[model samples]
Target: MKLVLTQFKIELLRIFRNPYYVFWSLAMPIVFYFIFTRVISTGATDAVAWNKHYLMSMTSFSVMGSAIMTLGIRLVQERSQGWSTFMRITPLPGAIFFLGKMFGQMIMHLSSIICIFLAGYLISGVTMPVHLWIYCGLWILIASLPFLAVGTLVGCMKRVDTASGVSNALYLVMAILGGMWMPIDILPKLMQAIGKWLPSYRFGNGAWELVQGNPPKWEDILVLAGYFIVFMLISLYTRRRQEAI
Candidate 1:
């Protein structure tokens, strides 16, 4: 148990020390939110709904970037560099590898929440419900599992460069198509239809629902949960095959 914790601690420290991780998980979201939200208020460009809407959407978008893209790419890179291979041979438990990745992703996401809160309160002047915060936090964590599984799969399946490239492009494209960067209502009808099929879109919309005081979304949650199981199973199956090879 202590050994697992130690491994997690080491990974956490390493994640924090990496500029790419820190910037993407910490600084980049703020920059995106601050600049775009501020620009939306200028009246030259129209926004989705209002200040609160911008707050909700941008926050969700940023969370996706941190947990999905930043963490995903890094994990893939680590795997490519023989990190996972060496760790696989270590006496340290395998669960530690997954757990450490989880902690790092979660910590990075905490930075997103802080920045969003700051943007909401300071810039947008939006007030949130106590229950809503709880809802978002729980749902966000739940949604993260699929992406975590994806990160693991990408790292396990491909070379680091390939995984990193694919993960980043996937995240960015999804962010745009999912209405994380723009309003889905304004997008082409085809884009709106396609976006619905994306996990990121569902994630952003789920978060948006809570902030908008919509009814609890059991269906969406279930979809994300299902994805988590499916992704994990696939990644695990593939890893076992690789080991055999």
Candidate 2:
């Protein structure tokens, strides 16, 4: 437990040291949210309908993108430097390393949520059910874990450049099809059908529901849990094979 916390602290410092995150992770979504709010708030009804759900979902996208893409790229870079191999030979338990990373991803989502909530509160008078905010925030974090695990497999299990290329390309494809760029309503039926399969789709919908003061349906949790299990198994199997080699 102590080792895990230590690793998590170190990983978090590395993430913050990037500096670029202050804009992309912290400020960009707030800017986008207010811009969208301004465009949509042309009337009284629109204002009435306006709340944190829309903004929160946007934050969710920001978290999903950052956790999957940024973390994925970092994982590959670290692996390429033989960091994973070195860790494997060290006193650090491999599970602790993965857990620390997963916790860092969760912390990233929490930070995004806080920034967006503050932006919405200050500018739009957007309010939320406090308990639901906590609830929904947790689900958003839960939904992201599998994608982080996916990054673990791709970045650590394969060549760094290939993993980076594949992860980014796949993120873009999933973002469009999964309605991260826009509401799923605007997507084609076939695309929406496919969105059901992508982790981000459920994340968006679950976040939307949470902001609306609704508990997530069981299936949202189920889908994310399933992905977590599947991806972790893949990563674990590959790690064992690498050891065998």
Candidate 3:
């Protein structure tokens, strides 16, 4: 128990201290939100609706980046620095180590969600029922699991440089295709078709629906779960292969 707590604390500190995590995961989303909603005003007819909808989009975007980029790169660096090997020889159980890291990531996700939510309220005067706020936050956090699995898969790469590049590519592609950058309704027909099938789109769709008083579609939950399973299986397989080398 103590070991898990200590490990969680260390992970938290490491995540927050990483400049990449701070800028990309935390700051960048808020900046983008401001730019889209405030600066390059589309003169949205329903400004409040667009503001609220985009809030969910940017929040999902931020959490996804944190899950796929920060966690993935850190795992690669740990392997290179011998941290993973050192931990293997320690008293820490493998499951506990994984749990600690996950809990830490969840904390980071929650913090990012709260910060972006606050920005929405303060800057754009976005408002919603208290229950809606809680639901949206929970939905975003839970929906991030598949991305975390993706990070794990990316972490399996041998080189940190390779992992970083791949993770960035995946992150940006998912964000754009998932409708996190703009509403899928406005995207080209082909992109809309592609985005609907993506986990990122499913992830954001849940929150967008929630804020509008609609329940998230069952397909969103099921698709994300399926992706999570597939990614985790592949990551496990890759890790085992690496270990056999």
Strongest candidate by lDDT: 3
lDDT of 3 by residue, 1-245 (tens): 78878889988887787777778876899999999988898777999889999999999999999899888888899999999999999988988888888888999999999999999998789999999999999999999999999989988888999999999998999899999998888899999999999999999999999988998999999999999999999999998898996
Q: How well does candidate 1 match the true structure in TM-score terms?
A: 0.87
Spell out the clash pairs found in candidate 3.
Answer: none
- Alpha-carbon lDDT of model 2: 0.75
Worst 10 residues of 3 by lDDT: 17-26
Considering lDDT, where higher is better, how would the candidates rank from best to worst?
3, 2, 1
Name the lDDT value of residue 160 in candidate 1.
61
What is the TM-score of each predicted model, taking all chains together? 0.87, 0.87, 0.97
Backbone clashes in model 2, listed as residue pairs: none
Give the C-alpha miss distance for residue 158 in model 2, angstroms: 3.6
Lowest lDDT 10-mer window, candidate 2?
41-50
Best by TM-score: 3
